[model samples]
Target: MIWVAIAISVCLGAAGQIFMKIAMRDAGPFPGLIGVVDIARYFWGAILSWPMLAAIVSYGISYVVWLGVLSRADLTLARPMVSLGYIMVILYGFYAGERMGWERVLGIVLIMIGLFLVVRSGARV
Candidate 1:
């Protein structure tokens, strides 16, 4: 059950990142450090954006699940597990027409190996 909650948190975090990336596509360049009014307009646009809304909701639920995961698991084990989100996000980027260079592929492979080892040792502790 703890592992399941951890997975939920990681997956939702990845989804949130993806959604935010999508939303940012339409958000023109940063409003800059000009003033609060410009910043508000930029933020208000994000709030009204559907993809941004989904990202916010995803992050909200992930945070709730993460609280449960932290309560039940060791922080060392749980923190590294969050890297699983990196794998999901990379996969999503690939799916969204992004190039998957060899370096990224290698990085994903390494993360998988590390996660496997972490989980194995954590099972003993």
Candidate 2:
């Protein structure tokens, strides 16, 4: 039951990140630190955009869901599950525009191995 909750949080977290990236693409790079409002306004517009709006709502729900998971699970277990988000980020990056190479693939494999060990070890606790 805890594991299931953990999985949901990780997946939701990953989806949140992907949605953020989609939002950022339209939002553009962060503004120079002339005024805080400058950055805030840019983000405000992004938040209003359709893709970003959806992303915001999704992440909002995900965050609430994640809090519930955290209440039931240990930090050790919950943190490891977030590695799943990194995997999702990599895949989304490639799909969005980033180049995929052998090194990236290797890194993904390593992350998966480490995450697997973390989860396997958690099962014992």
Best by lDDT: 1
Top-scoring candidate (TM-score): 1
lDDT by residue (tens digit), candidate 1, 80-106: 999999999999989898999999999
Query: Lowest-lDDT window of 10 residues in candidate 2?
Result: 116-125
Residue 22 of candidate 2: its Cα lDDT? 77
TM-score against native, each model? 0.87, 0.78
**Which regions of candidate 2 deviate over 4 angstroms?**
29-41, 122-125
Q: Estimate the overall C-alpha local distance difference test score of candidate 2.
A: 0.79
